[model samples]
Target: MSQAPDPTIHTLSEFLLHAGTNFQFFDLGRGVHPLDTQLFLDLENGLRPCPRPRQQHAWFAIVFWSEGQKPNHYIWFVKFPIDERGLLVAAARNHFLQIIVDALGQSLGEEKHDTLPDNPYSFVPTQSQMALFSAVTKSCLSLPFNDGVKEVEHYVNAPAISDWRKLSVQSIADFAQTLRDETTCHTVAQNMALYHEDFTRILLESAEAVSLPTAFKQHCAQYCADTFSSSPALALAALRALSSEQADTISQTLLNTLLDSKHADIHVLSVIAGRHYGQLSGHRLIQFFERAAALDEDESMEGKLFAGFFSDLVQLPCLRAEVLGVLRSTERSEVLARAFGHLFSQTQKK
Candidate 1:
């Protein structure tokens, strides 16, 4: 008798081939995009870097369709960290694959039932995140929107219903996906301020994954600016949800607002650094660096803010280069100089 495949293949594609007959992969890191298994394998072998690198980690989902009576598809949500080189860390992926191998044994393709225990390798996304993933997945797979979409629209359109809690996050996600439609975009823009904060946040969070119409983006920018004046927390949440293009103007507005505040909060600055770094214009970013330099002299929370911003900025080559240039050309204070030097040293050691 012929021996079965080893079932211990390290790469995702090979593991899937051994485990199931049909499968689909989706990337959930920065946005939702269909990923080819071959490309993923290439990433594993260090033949190529991850297609889109973000936040030093990647989120992905795998749909395994093993022929069975009770359940046909098993969905796995996984997050793996990337190395400094932007390639998948072999150890992280290997750990996840080992979990699957241990659970199912070698006969992975011939499973009789589809059931999974509490898996350590799997992660549960927040309601807003899950909504974004679902909407993107459906669009990528050419599947229909979920049944709850219409209900969400009804709740948002109805001023009579005072309770925003009635609307589900999924419905908001589906509605966001339709924002690509000009009519839907206009309608959402017009009714945006009327919605409750909770509802607006859901919509904004979901909007991050897809491009919004320009008119609608303008509305979001306005909302973010207004909210920042009233509540920086809500404003930051909305700001993070914006697409790169949309974030540019919104970020400028938020930065100006935050700087004008009596005492700038470190948390707010940290959020902007972590989420909206790329959205910032070069001029604005240099202004931020100057502010950091000044703050460093004061020796307050400058270290915390600089660390957060540096961590994110250093990951991008262009941004990293900008920081290096600033370190070289500008006459930074002693505190700022040491901070930048330490970051560079740590990165090289890594």
Candidate 2:
């Protein structure tokens, strides 16, 4: 007997479009955001690269359903690896869709999960990610009034300290998305001092991957600068928020300040390296490595920071070559040499 090949669809959007369905796409790489379907199509077609590339992988989700079945929409959270240039690995996506077809068949329905096979590509996001995604999805679907939206709008305006527990994570995300308003921006800045550390941490994580408004960006830079001298933890949190928006000016200034110091703070260095390193100028990267190498010893705090930062920067699509160039240069530090050797050894295995 001849076995039949598995049925499959190619791109996710293709599957939805074929059924004349409605859909929402969210990019889950750094944080959740409404991904443009055209950009996704371009990525699948090799006409463009991933817009927000991180570690050469793009994580995203798509929710789709028939017109009357909004509540029953299917959500698929998948992460796909890209090449050095940020293009998707075609075979990987194809294989995933093929497996999905084999397991779940050609149709989507409320009963689909009953027969669906265990999928490697499906993922459960962290609590913060789930909250942010929920916020984005609600906005996209234009569902009935969200209490989170109403509460955030009021909270930013009134500046109250009732209880951090009372505020929803979705509200924080909603507030972050609406920071274009000057009043909201000012209110949030002013109220940061009153916020609990846990609340601040959650908000920072939500804001970390979002695009802040220009006004908010300016206010944030000033606020973080002033606070950095007093509270380094809060400053780093604010920096993480700024980093995702590609806030180069403030981040660059901070990086320079740390590089010029003999005893740099490891926490600050790690945040900058993990979040802002992708957008750093090549000159800054060169200067950074040189300064990092000048640290007292390979086993010191500065050296540990350098290793952590370099390991992260080496994985970014934009910085891979720049990192390699620095690694191969004669001036490379012993600490960096060790990191470089480990990175290549792992790469060779893949």
Candidate 3:
């Protein structure tokens, strides 16, 4: 009788490779962006921290499939907590791995396991998020486009005849993920003004998850400026759709304009903190906190807005040091200073 193969699967990456599977990792925290395989291995091995954390946790999706088999992929939506310094909590990861080992043992890759054990670490993404994730993953694998892609393409090509309301969000998401040519991007940009508000909102929301072409970004920056005062919601959606990297002069200028607004409301402030926190640095970083602190003080809410956003931003590995520096800065305005004091007082009470 042949001895049972070693049941000791050490890491998720190892388990996948052992199971004769090809896999991809995507960071679902801030956006549905692909995660480098090596970086994920390093994170699992405790060699480094999660680079893109949201709400103090590292949320990611693993899509895997067997080699030389039909393209029926399986996904695991897993989240693990990060320490104050942003390192993965080994205990939580170990617990999850132990559960996997107990459930599947040494036969993990031998057969397709459609479901994982129910656990707190697993979560279901929103419908829009799911659509975006599926679109991105399929695009990465060079798979055939979903049927919705042609409908979206038709709408983009000839919006006069296409019924905008009939376009499914999934098709829009697939188009956003697969769009690459400058001509297609230009067409999308030129047609933006003609799209219904509902269609435009869905398009912008879908665009927020992917890296767009330069032409598209430029047009979006202009669109955002055109509607900044007249249509704040549409403007905000446009801002969210703009690349967080903000590589060009126009994008950077628009972001600066939003941040520098003295009358920035909670919606504007939250969008900056959530979608574009990556743009915060040096003077811009200080400006963001200052603007957040200067919000119209509600007697009932007090410093909750500032404190809540601060707590979230400070937990990010990329922003932690800059956030701490802001906290210790002497150049803060009187309102900002008072907000910090209230934050500290509240923390102590807790």
Best by TM-score: 3
Predicted candidate 2 versus true structure: per-residue lDDT over 1-350, tens digit per residue = 22223234467668667656678788776556687889888777777777655556778888877776446667778878787667888877876777766665555665773344677666778877777777567656775434666666555555463556778887787556555456666677778777777677667666765667776776666666777777777777777777753547766776676666643455665566666775566667766765655452444553444555665666665667788788657766565576556556755777
lDDT of 3 by residue, 9-69 (tens): 5678887787777899999887788888999988888888787788889999998886665
The TM-scores of all predictions, comma-separated, are 0.77, 0.77, 0.92
- Top model by lDDT, which number? 3
In order, the Cα lDDT scores of the candidates are: 0.66, 0.66, 0.79
**Candidate number that wins on TM-score, 2 or 3:** 3
Off by over 4 Å in 2: 1-8, 45-56, 69-73, 83-86, 113-116, 139-145, 158-161, 228-230, 244-247, 258-267, 290-311, 327-350
Q: How do the residues 262-322 of candidate 1 rate in per-residue lDDT, one tens digit apiece? A: 3345555555565556655455665566566456546665355566566666565446667
Model 2 TM-score, 2 decimals: 0.77
TM-score of candidate 3 relative to the true fold: 0.92
Determine the C-alpha RMSD for candidate 2 after optimal superposition of all C-alphas: 4.4
**Model 1, backbone clash pairs (residues 3+ apart or across chains), number:** 0
TM-score of 1: 0.77
Cα displacement (Å) at residue 34, model 2:
3.6
RMSD of each: 4.6, 4.4, 2.9
- After TM-score superposition, the amount by which residue 298's alpha carbon in candidate 2 deviates from its true location, in angstroms, is 5.0
